[model samples]
Target: MKEQYMITHEPPNPVDYNNLRLEGGMSGKSREASEEGLKNSLFVVCVYDEETFIGMGRVIGDGGTFFQVVDIVVKPGYQGQGLGKLIMEHIMNFLEKHTYPDSYVSLIADGSADKLYKQFGFSYTYPKSRGMYRKY
Candidate 1:
């Protein structure tokens, strides 16, 4: 039996954003931070099971030259259910339509999730340019 989930460009509310991340084993962010940050989303796809928020993926960048795929999360109970791929499909569609030839799309795949991104034509940058981030 296939479950029905709604995928929408409308992002979750601040509470949902913070809760769903924690539910999916990702780190938590303050509701205040989420409220402010979400307003700046370049593109976002939020997944819902009935009215319950379950998963989401967001693209954030300066609108050109660079795009970072962030917050790709599916609730623990919903893992391995193809929700991540669905989120990526929408994210890719946004990129395809908006990106220029020189645009760079980047992500940090935690654990084995890199396999999923690879299917979408993402290549790792190694032996050349490496990634650096300042996580507080």
Candidate 2:
């Protein structure tokens, strides 16, 4: 059966970050960091099919000068559908409404998803700038 879904800017809960294990690094963050991140973030999108959460995404950073899109995820069974696009469309829409004219909005596009993000005006910064990560 095709699932009907709704997207919301509010997180499922402040602690769902820990409860749902939605951390983006090698291992999930501690409950305190996760809670603080959510509380301080400017944007969050949670996708639900009826009552079951099928996906989520968020944007974090200083609201005025920099914004990074993070934690975009879809439940495994819901993969291959256009839900990622839907989730990202919301992210784009949020950026449209809130981003200052000269502010930068960015994401670390994964796997083949760069193609999808390109359609929304995202480009590779590889040659001009490299993306580096620090692991703890």
Candidate 3:
């Protein structure tokens, strides 16, 4: 049977976001943090299997010059179903429609996930620049 899912240009609720993240092998965030983050995102895309949130991705930045793709995740059971690509496609569409020529769009690809981002034109920056992050 073919599974049916709906993609929307909406941010998932805090609970759904955290649940999807955890189920997708990413760390969960506090409800407060998730709420704040979703509210601040420049753009968000969510995938649902009927009423069940199954995946999500969001773009965050100053809305100009610098935009980062974050929280790209799909539920474990839905991982191999091309939902990740669907999420990225929506994100890339937003970037294309809203970003300027000099804008710097980036993402920190974990593990083999870089391969997925590469299909959307993300390239390695290691030779000329390195990605660094700090956790508080």
Candidate 4:
């Protein structure tokens, strides 16, 4: 049989994005915010099972000086099937083409997911620098 998965370089619609975030055990975003945020993304990778959006990852930032890997999520049913890494592969390709030596790339890994990020050369920035955030 042919493969059932399709990877596309496109962002999910706002509603799908919010629903997938919740399905993936992450916080949901408002439609307006999701729309605007996605519109500004430098690159996006979306995975679909046939036609249903199941996983996605994105790179967002000023496009030159800084970049952040975010919204890396796969549905609970789709986790552990290599979908996350597949998504990262696409994001890494985009970064490899666009980022420069001075560009800073970062992501805030959650729980055991840090291990996955480490596979992509991400390391903890503690002791020397810590991550702090104020969510509105």
The Cα local distance difference test for each model comes to: 0.91, 0.79, 0.90, 0.92
Off by over 4 Å in 2: 1-3, 18-27
Ranking by lDDT: 4, 1, 3, 2
Q: What TM-score would candidate 2 get against the native?
A: 0.86
In candidate 2, residue 7 scores what lDDT?
A: 73
**Candidate number achieving the greatest TM-score relative to the actual structure:** 4
lDDT of 1 at 32: 80
lDDT of 4 by residue, 23-94 (tens): 998998999999999999999999999888889999999999999999999988878988888889899999
Error of 1 at 66 (Å): 0.7
TM-score of each: 0.95, 0.86, 0.95, 0.96
**lDDT value for model 3:** 0.90
Error in Å for residue 44 of model 3:
0.5
Steric overlap count per candidate: 0, 0, 0, 0
Candidate 1 lDDT, 1-136, residue by residue in tens:
1468877998789999999988888899988889988999999999889988889999999999999999999989888889999999999999999999999999999889999999899989877788888977
Q: For residue 131, what is the lDDT in candidate 3?
A: 91
| Model 4 poorest ten-residue lDDT run | 1-10
Off by over 4 Å in 1: 1-3
